[model samples]
Target: MTYPQDPYGQQQPYGQQPPYGQPYQQPGYGQPGYGYGPAMPPQDQGLAIAALVVSIASLVVCTGLLSVIGVIMGHIAHSKAKRGEAGGQGMALAAIIIGYIGVAIIVGLVLVFVIVGIATDWDFD
Candidate 1:
């Protein structure tokens, strides 16, 4: 029987193994080729969230030191989350919200204090 020639002219018989000691390689088999594997779970998620929360809260307390720390923590958390290191989305978001609220309160208080001071002191020279 005349076998049909393959594209490479390599006559591969059906259900027959490759030549012995020829390093047989199957198409799309056990090779480390393309496609990704299962996604690994994140680590240190809780820590990141905690940091974010602390930082945000500090802002409201009028403690720049705490706020700075919080900001730094939040940034770290965000980076980890982005890189799939830790699942800290909720914590990071809470931290951000709290921080904003704290800042707003501080600003408002300062504004009120300033306004009150200016109003009470009316010395026209």
Candidate 2:
């Protein structure tokens, strides 16, 4: 800490490198940091989101087909998220629940129809 000290190290000869080597080193070049290892991959959320969308659509479209698709997509999303390859776990769960609900609704309607038809039989002799 002297008054006439040099920050860049003792003055180098004309057109010479400063002491201590290159002033800075690029990262990932074994320079301490700079993504020395595989970069963190972006999470794939398509499955999770698709599951949610299909589940919602099931209520309006083919309750059986769409709901089945939603359930599959949700399972895939959950698997990917578990492997640290995707996001939106909550969305996947919601999709699964909704898909099941859709399936249940369809089943309930069929049962109701059968019950009413049986109850009102004319018993034509």
Candidate 3:
């Protein structure tokens, strides 16, 4: 099969190449002896994403349970980052902090309610 450059002036045939003054271009890995090598595989980000999302949602939704989950996931993600298993250390830390704040808010509200109830002599019975 003849691989002729259709219509266009550039003739990129099978064995033939561009005329002089044109630099030879390799597919992806350039140069000889040294190759670009395979692209780095993406690091696992499940824990990191979960931590951040859960923390943010908890903070906005004011849900203590999700905040706790966020804190747990954050710690796991941070550990993974330390061991070079994953990334997003900053994200994990932020999630942990946010989670703590959410938990604190929840506890604070509970305490406030309890104090108000006792002051008013509210009876559960």
Tell me, by lDDT, which candidate is best: 3
Per residue, candidate 3 scores C-alpha lDDT tens digits across 57-90 of 9989999999999999999999998899998888
Kindly list the per-residue Cα lDDT of model 1 for residues 22-70, writing each as its tens digit.
4455543566655668776546777666777577558645775566566
What TM-scores do the predictions have? 0.53, 0.63, 0.66
Clashes in candidate 3: how many? 0
True-structure lDDT of candidate 1: 0.66
Tell me, by TM-score, which candidate is best. 3
Which residue pairs show backbone clashes in model 3? none
C-alpha lDDT of all candidate models, in order: 0.66, 0.79, 0.83
In every candidate, how many clashes are there?
A: 2, 0, 0
lDDT of 2: 0.79
**Any runs in candidate 1 off by more than 4 Å, and if so which?**
1-42, 56-64, 122-125
Error of 3 at 32 (Å): 10
Which has the better lDDT: candidate 1, or candidate 3? 3
- Clash count for candidate 2 is 0
- State residue 90's C-alpha deviation in candidate 2, in Å: 1.2
